[model samples]
Target chain A: MKSLHAQHHPLADTGYQLTVLTQAEVEGAHQPLFATRLREAGLLPLRPTGITVMQVNVGKMCNQTCRHCHVDAGPDRTEIMTRATMQQCLDALRQTPIEVVDLTGGAPEMNPDFRWFVEQISALGREVIVRCNLTIIVANPKYYDLPEFFARHRVRVVSSLPHFSAVRTDAQRGEGVFGRSIKALRMLNEAGYGVEGTGLSLDLVYNPSGAFLPGNQAALEREFKQRLVREHGVVFNSLLTITNLPISRFLEYLLDSGNYESYLDKLVQAYNPVAAANVMCRSTLSIGWDGQLYDCDFNQQLDLLVDGRAPQHIRDFDLAALNERSIVVNQHCYGCTAGAGSSCGGATT
Target chain B: MEKATYYNPADLAKFGNITEWQPEMGRKFFDYYGEVFKDGALTEREKSLIALAVAHAVQCPYCIDAYTTDSLQKGADEAQMMEAVHVAAAIKGGAALVHSVQMMNKAKELSM
Candidate 1:
C-alpha cells in the first residue's frame, strides 16, 4: 500500500488531520473535548513530569506501508534526518540527563547514519532503543547483520507484530510480513536479544489491527509468548500493547471505513484519569526528522510542535523550558488515556 | 416510535439506561454480569468467546455487537471468534436435527 503522502491524500497534511480530529463531528455522537476531560481530571494544561525518553524519528522511509501506520511511512517517503540533525540530537543528549534515546523511522536502520548514531548514543552511556520494523532486518543483504550490531551496542529492540497469525498480521501490515518478522525474530534470538539471561531486552508491540483498543497487556503478552514459542520457537521479553491513535493513515482509515466517530467515542468513553496523568508525553520528547521537537510521536505526526514556551528545535534543547511548557494535545490524546492507557513501553496504568 | 426500523445500532450505547427505571435490578444484573466476565476457571477471553457464541445462539443483535467488540478487546482473534460463532451454529443446528429421533419414533408407533 502506498502512503497517504504518496497517494496525495489530504489526510497526509498534518494540519488537515488535526482539523478533521478537532472540527469534524459525526451526527449523534457527542465527542467530549480531550482538554476538557483532562481539566476534569485536574490535568488541564498538562506539563511534562520530566524528560526520560528522547524519541527520535530518524526518517519516514519505511520498507512497507502498513495500513494503521500513524507515521504514513513507506518506501516512497524521503524524509530522512541528516547527520547534522543527528549531531544536534547527540549534543542535546549530552547536555541533558535523559537516560534513554529511542530511534524510530520508516526504518531507523535504513538511515545511512543509523549505525553511527547508535554507536554515538551508546558511547554516551545512554540506553538506546531501536523501534525496528522486524522485516527491515531481513529485507536486504546489508541489513542481515543488524542483530549482531544491536547486540554489540546492547540496544533494546522493539518491533511491532500486530498478531501472531499470519493472516491477521498480514491483513494490517502487508502480505508475507509475518513470515519475514518471524525470520527476523529468530535472528534476534540467535543474537540473544530476548534470551532469559542475556539481559538484552527485545520486546514486541501489539496494536489492534482494526478500530478497537488493545486487550489486557499481561494476558496478551502471555498468549504471544506461548504461541510464538510453540509455533515458531520465537521468544521475547514482553509485548507492548499500543492503542492506535487516530492520525495520518489511521485517521484516513477511520474516515474511509466510517469508524471515525464511533472509534473516537470508544476512546473517550474509556478514558482513565490515572492513564491521563501518566501519558508518555509527560516524560518523553519526540524529535522529528528535521530536528523539530514535539510532545510525542503522535503529535509529531500531526505537526503539533511543542508549546511555544519550550525550545521548538533540538538544536535549542532546553530541558528547563520544555519541562515548564504544557504538552500540546487534541482529541487524539484520548487514545493514550483510554482503558489501561498506552505508551511506548506498554500500558501506562 | 417514529423510526421505521425496530432496532437501531445506537441503542447499544443506551443499554445502560436500563438502570434509569429499575435501578436496583439493573445494578444487580450489571454487577453479576461484570463478575461473570472476570478471569476464573474460564479466562475472560474464553468467557468473551462464550458470550459471543451465546449472542449468536440467541440471535441478539445488541449482544452480538457488544460481545464482538468485547471479544476483540479480550484478545480473541478473528479466526478464534469466528470459530466460536460456528460452534454456536453447529449446536443450534444439531439441536433441531437431534429432534428427528422423536419424530421418527412417533411416526413408527402411529403406523403400527
Candidate 2:
C-alpha cells in the first residue's frame, strides 16, 4: 500500500522480471493475497485439488496484436511449441487423468504442426479446445480449411470477439478484425458448431474492451446471441464473459490509462468469497510453451512457474507431487476472484 | 488525528484505522460488510450500481469513490452508471417532495 504507483507501472519493457516486483507487492500490500482472502473465508491452500483441465500454450506466435493480449503474442513472436514439447504434453495427458486438453497461443493454430497436435489430442479421447483468435481463421489461406478440420475432429472452439459491434471488436483487437471474426464465426456455424444437435461446441469469449470487468454472464450471452443471430446470421453454443486479469498487455493498459491504482483497488473491493472458492486454479493445470507448469494461464503468463516440489515441467509431471504443492499466487489474482469470478472457460461462480 | 472535514479521499485507504480504535466491533463489521457483496440474488454488478446510487444519496465521498470504481470494474458503462446516479437523485428528490403533503395537511388543519 506504500504508494504502489511504482509497482503499478506497466512492465511492457521488463517482461517476466515483473514477477519479482509482483511477488513483492503481494507480500507487502496492506491488503491480503486473494489466497489469504480465500483462507479467511475458509478456503485454505490445498494441493492441486483436482486437475480436470490441462491448458497448454502451444506458442506465442500470433497473427494480430490485441491491446490486452496476456500472452504478449504477435506476428514477430518467434517462440513456438516444438514437436517434442507437444509430444511431452501428450505424454503427460496420457499418464494423467486430465480429460480436457485446452490449446492456447498467440494463435494456437499458427504452429506448423497444430493440425497434427489436435488430431493427436483427440486420439487420446480428450476433449480438445482451441483458444482461437477469430482473425486467425481468415488471416491467411492456410487457415481457410480450419472449419472443415475442426468439425472433423469435433474440436471445441473458444474465440474472443469482444462485442457484437465491429467498431468495438476492431477497436480492442485491431482494425478489420471484426469482419474476419464474423466470417470465421459463420464458417464455424456452417461446420455445425452452435447448431442444435451437432455436438461440436463453438463458444465465444467476451472480455471487456477496456479496464473494466465484464458484465453479467447470462445477460451478456443473451444480448450477444440476439445480435449475432439478428445481424450476422451467426450462431454459437455459449458465450463466456471474462474479467480481464491485470497482467501483460492489460496491466499495461491500466497503467498507461491511469486506471492502475483504482482498478486494483476496485478488484480488491469487489472480492467475492464464492467466486474465490471456485477459482480455476483449484482445478486446472497450465502448461507453458516450453512445457513449464503453472497454477493457471495468468500465472503461466507471469512465468511464476509452479512451486518448487511440484513437477516443474510437463516432461516431469507427477500427479501426486502436483497434487501436494500449494498454488503460487499474487496480486494479479484479484482479477480472477473479482465479481462473478473468471477462468479460461469463463466465470466460476 | 481528526480533520475538520468529516471525509477525505485519502482517508478511504486509511479507513482500516477504524479497527485500531475499536478492534472488536470494527473487525466484525468489516467481515459482515464483505459478505453482503458476494454474487447472490443480485450480481456484484447489480450491487455496485445500487451502491453507486446509494453513494449519491448518502453523499459519502468515500463510498462514492469506492462504488464509482466498483461500478466500472463490474462493467457498468459510464452512461449506465450516470443513470444510476440519476435514479438516486430522483428518488431522493421524490422522498422530500412526497413529505411535503404533510406540510399541506398542517396548513389545511390550521385554516380549518
Candidate 3:
C-alpha cells in the first residue's frame, strides 16, 4: 500500500510535484477540482494573521543529535537555564494568562530546574508543556524515572519518533536510540498514556526523513497505529504531520545533497493560508532556560525578542504587555505558515 | 520493500541520471523550478539557505549534499548556513518535547 501511494505521488522524494493546478492552470487543463481545493485551502497565497506567542529558549543541550536536528544540540552544549530564569518564568506565569507555556531546550528535562518550573506552572493551573526527548528517560539511570516524575506533575510530554520502523528511526537519531524510544513508549502506554478513553494523550510526531512534507495526518496516524500495534504493541493518541522547516542543520543537509532549489520550490508551492492563519506562535508562549522571551522557539534561537514594554527576560515577565506585543518574523516565518502549517504542537490548520 | 542504495559524497558526486518515468511532470517542475529560484518574495540566496536547512531537518542525505553547495554558491556563508540548520534543530527538538504530556498523564493514571 505504501509503495502504491508512492507510485501515485512521485513527489515523495523532493515534494515538488505540481499535483494540484492553480485556477489559471485548470483553465488551460481538463481537471479543475484539484485547483478548487488548492484555492479553498488558500494555497494560492496571501499574508495571514500575525500575533505573538512568547517563546523561551531554555538552552542548547540535548540527549540526541539526530541527523535533522536544527538546534545542533548535544551533551557538548553547556548553555542551560539558570535558577534566576526559572524564577522569572514563574513570575511571568503569575502575571500572564497566556494560553500555553512552551518550555523547550536541548532536552528540557536536562535542565536542572525542569521539574520545578513544570510544578510551578501546573500549580497555577495553566497549560504547561515540556518537550521531552524520549531517550532522555533512558539516556542515564538518573533520568530513568522521568515518566513517573512528569506524570506526578501533569506535564505534557511531546516526543519524536520519525517512523514506527526501527531502521528509519535509528538512522536519524543514532544507534540504540530507537530501541530506547520504543521501550519508553511502552512504559508510557502501560501507564495509559496512548490508550483510547484515556485523557492521557500520547501523540507521536513524524517528519519525512527526506525532502517531502508528510502526507495526511489522519491517514498516517491510522497507518502508524496498525504498524505499531502489530509489530511492537505500541499506541499513541495522534500523529502530528509537520513540514520540515528549511533552516538549520536540515538546510546544511539539503545543500550538501544538492536538493536546495527543488525543496524550496516545494515549500513555496505548497504554502497553505489556512495553516498561516492559525500558526502556533499566535497562542503559545516560549520561555528560554534563563527566562528570556521571544515570539516562538524558532525566533528565540535567532535572538529575535518580542517588541513592547514587557520584561525581555522571564525575570520581569508581564503577560499582558507581552501578549499585546507584536511578533518579529522573517522570511523563515513562511515555513510555519506554509501548507498545513507546522508547530511544536502539530499542524495548526 | 526495495533495498535502496544510500549515497555517500563520493557516490553522490557520480550521480547524474535523472529519472525518466515522469517526463511531463519533470519538465514542468524544471520550468517552475527556474521561476522559484528567481528573487521574488524570497531571494535566490534566501531560498538556498531555507532548502539547506530543510534538508537537515528532513535528514535527506541527497538533499543535504545538494543544498550545502547551492547555499554556498548563492553566497550563504558557513555561519549563516549553520544558523539556519540550528533553527531546524530547535523546532524539531521542541516538537519532540511538547508531546511528553502523554507520558506524564499516562503515568499518573496508572500510578493512581
Residue range B1-112, candidate 2, lDDT tens digits: 7667766677888988899989999999999889998878987777889999999999988999889767755555566788999999999999999989999999999995
lDDT string, candidate 2, A112-188, tens digits: 98999999999999999999888788888989889899999989999998988777688789888999899988888
Candidate 2: the clashing residue pairs are: none
**How many angstroms is residue A142 displaced in model 2 relative to the true structure, after the best TM-score fit?**
1.2
- The TM-score obtained for chain B by all candidates, in the order given, is 0.93, 0.90, 0.76
Question: Candidate 1 residues A1-349, lDDT tens each?
Answer: 7899988888878888887888744333378788888899999889889999999999999999999999999999999999999999999999999999999988999999999999999999999999999999999999999999999999999999988889879989999999999999999999998999999999999989999999999888988999999999999999999999999988888999999988988998999999999999999999999999999999999899999978999999999999999999898999999999999999998
The candidate that wins on TM-score is 1
Native contacts conserved, per model: 0.65, 0.40, 0.00
**Candidate 3 vs. truth: CA RMSD?**
20.3
Residue A7's lDDT in candidate 2: 39
Q: Residue-pair clashes per candidate, as listed?
A: 0, 0, 62
User: Residue A47's C-alpha lDDT in candidate 1?
Assistant: 84
DockQ for each numbered candidate: 0.74, 0.24, 0.02
Q: lDDT of model 1 at residue A52?
A: 92
Interface RMSD of 2: 3.9
Better of 1 and 3 by TM-score: 1
> Cα deviation of A167 in candidate 1 (Å)?
1.3
Where is model 1 more than 4 Å wrong at Cα? A24-29, B1-3
Question: What is the C-alpha lDDT profile of model 3 across A198-300, one tens digit per residue?
Answer: 6676778886666656655665676678778898998888888766766555665666687765666556666676766677766666666656666777666
Candidate 1 structure lDDT: 0.93
